[model samples]
Target: MTTSQRWISTAINHALLLGAIELEQTDRGTRPHRLPAAARAQWPDPQLLMVEGQPSGMRLAFRTTATAIELETIPTKRIYVGMPPRPDGVYDLLIDGQLARQGSVSGGDSLTINMSTGSATHERGAPGVLSFEGLPAGDKTIEIWLPHDETTELVDLRTNAPVEPIGTNGAPVWLHHGSSISHGSNATHPTGTWPAVAATAAGVSLINLGFGGSAIVDPFVARTIRDARADLISIKLGINVVNTDAMRLRAFGPAVHGFLDTIREGHKTTPILLMSPIYCPIHEDTPGPTAPDFVDGKLSFKASGDPAEIAMGKLTLNVIRDTLSKIVTQRAATDSNIHYLDGRDLYGEVDSAALPLPDRLHPDGDTHRLMGERFAALAFAPGGALAH
Candidate 1:
C-alpha cells in the first residue's frame, strides 16, 4: 500500500490492534537481553528466569514452566545500531535470533499476553520490561532487539516461581509524568522514584514516563497520558524547560494548551492535575540577562529569569501557574473531574521547612517520601481533590 493509504488504514484500524507481543529465543544461552540507558525513552525489560541489579536495567532469566506471557508497557522510542544519528526508535523482537515481534509502538499502547492461563505474565512496568506468561516450566531464552543508541542494561523479569503473590485486590494504577527529578535522578532504585514512593503509599501500579532532560510540554506526552490506563494521574511540569531555557514566550503558551488539549482527547474525563515546577532560584523571576557562575568549579545557573517577562505579557512561572489555574478553574466549571494542585502545595515554603531539596531543584529520596506522604493526604486521601 502507498504511504498515504497505510496511514489511513492504520488510523482506521488502530483501535482493533491491541495485545502484548513476544520475542522468544530457541537458544537458552541468551536468556536475558540487556537494555541500556543509551536506548530511547521506551522499551521492554529483558525476560528471564533470574534477575540481577536494581531492576531498572537489570537482567532476567527464562524458566521452563512458563508457557505464555504478556507485557503491558511503555516504549522508550529510541533505538540504536552502534551508531550516531541514533536510530529513530525501538528495536524489533527476535526469537532465537529471528524477527518475532515488531518493536514499533504509538504514544500509548498496551501489550496483552497471548498465552493461556496458569502461565506467568510478568509486568516490569520499567520504561522497558519484557512482558511474558506461559512456559514449559523448563529453561527458555527471551531476546529483545537492543536499541543501538543505548548502552545495554538489563532490567527485571517476572517468573512462575513459587512466591508470595501481591494480593487479591490487585495494585492501583498510578500514572505519573515529571522532570528528571521524578526520573530517579539521584535515587537508589527504579522503584525509588518519588512517584514510585507515592505509588507504594497508595498501593498502586506505577506508569512512570518521567524523561530525563526532556520534560518540556510535549503533545506526545499528553496523548500518552490520555490513552494510558490509570486509576490516578499526576503531571509534574515546568523546571526542565526553565533550566534549559527552552522557551522564551511565544512558544510556551500554545505548548501548554496543546499539551492539555492532547491529553483531554483520550481521557475525556479522567481526573487530571497540573503541577508547577519545584523551587529553583536559578530559574525564578530573573531574566536571561543573568550569568552563570561556579561553586567548586561546577557550573551553576542563576534564575536570571524576568518576572517582567510575564508582566509585559511574556510567559513565566507566574504566567504558567496563572495560565494553568485559570484554565483548570475554567475547566472545572464545565468539567468537574478536572483539577489543579500547586506544586508548591506539594513542597511549598511550609513543607520545605525541614526538608530542603539538596540541589534546590530535585527532591531527595527522603524528601520524596515526605512529598509522597503529603500527596497521599492532600490528593489521594478520602475527600481529597483527586478522590473527588
Candidate 2:
C-alpha cells in the first residue's frame, strides 16, 4: 500500500474481475483481456486490436464496507472526425445488485478515427478520477462496469475502509459474440447496450466478445469461445461479413460450420444459439460493401454492392438468414441443444419502421432497449432457446 497516495493495489483484496481471461499489467495500470494473449498474437489487424483492447463486459466487483470509493483511470476515448462528439464512456456503480450511481471521467486520451479513410490518430491526456460517496454503513457488493466502447486502464482504487474481493455470485455465464451492434454502438450507456440489458434481465454474467467491424467468423474467435467457461453461448453473425464483402455463400456456410465445430469441441452440449442478421433494409437483398452516408453531417450506412451479385451467391441479410436457418435445422437434428433465433425476431421490419436505425446499421438507444427486452423474453425465458 502506498501511504503517500493512499491507493491500494487492485490486485489485493476487494477487486474481482469477471469476463476477462487475463490482465496485462502496464506502467499506467492494468488492461483486461477477453481473448487469451496467444489468440491476440495470431490476428494483428489494427481494428481487431482496438476492439479487443476495449473491455466491453468487464467489471470490477468487490465487497467493501467503505462509505466512499474512488478510482483513477486512463481511458482512451474515441473520436470520429467531422462528427458530433460522443459522450464519455460511463462507469456504472451497482451497489448490492441495483444501480446506485453512474459516473464518467471527463478527461482522457483521445483516439481520433476517420472511418471514411480507416485511419486513426492518438493523443495523450491525463488520467481522471471517478468518485462515489455516502454509502450505507454496512458491507455491500460494488460492481464498477467499465466503459463498453473505450479502452480503459485501471490505475488505482481507493476507499475509506478496507475491502475484500467478491467471489462468484452464482450467476450463469452468457458468452456472446457479434459485431459493433453488440459492442454497444449508439447505446446510450454501457449498461444500456442490448447484451448488458439482456444479461441483467436474464440474471447472467456476461462475457461480451462483440468487436466492432471484426466479427467475421474468424477461427481465433471460435477457438476463444471453445476455451471460455460459459453456460450459454450465442453468435450474431453475417453483417460484418456482408459489409466487408468477406465471403460468398460457399465460404459462408463452411466458415459458419467450422466456427460451430470448434465451439462444440469444448462445449458439446452447451446451448448455443445462432442468430441471423436483423432487418437491415439496405443490405436486405443487396450485397455490401456498405458505405457510410454522411447525411447532413450525421453518419448513416448504405449498401454499395450490386444487388445483381445475389445470382452468384454473394451474401445478403436475407440469404444469410436462410442459410443460418438451414444450418441450425441440420445441426439440431444431431444435436438438440443447438438452436437458432432469427435476428429479425429481435429487430425486424416493423421495429425498423417505427424505430429506424439512426445510422442505418446500428440501433439507437430505444431500439436497443426494445431488442434487449425482446431477446431476453425470447432466449432466456422458460422454454426459450437459451433457457437453462
Candidate 3:
C-alpha cells in the first residue's frame, strides 16, 4: 500500500536535538549551533563561525511508524583553497539504535576556505534529498546524524507515517569538548567520531562541543559548558592551543583555571574529567602555528614554529600536557569529583604506530574507533576516572 506522505518542518519539538545550544532560523533553513547566540556575537571570528556552523554532534531523532522517509537539506561543504576536492559529507541513518544506512547528498552549496588568508567564498548549489525506503513498520526510533564536517541546513522532512520526538527518560548526559580530533574530522561518519563511539559504549546521551581549529580556551565556550545540563563532563584540551599558537605558558595555566572555574559553577559536584592532548608527533616537542603542506594536493600539517621557542614559554603539546596534569592534580586534591586522564592513554605512541594520523593532525577512521573504544574502557569502565 502506498501511504501518503506529509512534509514537516525541523522543529525542536518534532525531533531531539543533541549538542546544539541554539538554532539559527534563516531563509535557507534552520542551522543547529554548539555555541549560543551570545558567544557567537562576542567572538565573530570567521573561523569560529565556520567551525560552529558544522554540526559536530547534532542529530535529528524521532519515533515514527513510517515505512518510507525523505529529508531535504542544504549542506555547505568546505573546500580548502589549495587542497584537492573532497567527498560529500555523509548522513547516517539509525533505526532502533543501530546504523541502517550511510549516504551522501549529491548537490549542495560549497564554502571555499583559504586557510592561510582566513577567508571564505560561497558557491551556491541546489538542495539535496536523502531518501530511505522500506523502513520497518510499527513504531520505531529513527535518528539521522548530520554530517560532522559540513554546515547543514535542515530544509524539510517527509514521512509516510506520523513522527514525534523521543524524550531522554533520565539517560545520563555526557557533555564533551575538544579540538578537531573530537569534531569527527577524519572519521568515517558522524557516529564514528570518537566521542560518539564512547557515548554509545557508555550508554549516555552526548553533547559534543568539539570545534575544528576553534577550541582555543575561549571564555564564552567555557560559559556554554557551564550552563549545559550534563551529569558527566569531559574536556580534551591543548591541541588547538598549540596548533594556533593562541597562548603562551604564562597565560595557558590561568586560562585553563578560569575555564574550569566557570564550568564548576554550574556543575559543582558533577564528574569532570580533564584530558590532555593525544599524541601528535609533530607538535610533541616542537611549538606550533601548525602549517599545512599540500603534497600533490593532499593536506598534511607540519609544525611551523621553532622548537627553541619553548624556552620563551611558547606552548607545545608536551607543555600543555604537563600543565594540564598539574592543574588537575591540584584541583583533585581539593575536589574529589575532578579527575585527570592523559590523552596518551586514549592514543599514545604504540597506538599511533599502529594507527597513525593521516593528516599529521587528525586521526584516521580506524584511530577514531580505537580512541573511542579506549576512552570508553578508561573513563566509563568501573574504577576509571569518570566512573561513578
Alpha-carbon RMSD to native, per candidate: 15.1, 2.4, 1.8
Whole-model lDDT values for every prediction? 0.49, 0.87, 0.87
Where is model 2 more than 4 Å wrong at Cα? Answer: 1-9, 12-15
Query: Which stretches of model 1 miss by more than 4 angstroms?
Result: 1-152, 155-169, 248-250, 287-293, 297-301, 306-308, 312-314, 351-353
Worst 10 contiguous positions by lDDT, candidate 2: 5-14
TM-score of 2: 0.95
How would you encode candidate 3's per-residue C-alpha lDDT over 120-139 as one tens digit per residue?
89998889998888888899
How high is each candidate's TM-score?
A: 0.58, 0.95, 0.95
Clashing pairs in 2: 14-164, 14-165
Residue 269's lDDT in candidate 3 = 95
Error of 1 at 170 (Å): 2.9
Could you tell me the lDDT of residue 382 within candidate 3? 96
Question: Candidate 1: what lDDT?
Answer: 0.49
Candidates 1 and 2, the one with greater TM-score: 2
Better of 1 and 3 by lDDT: 3
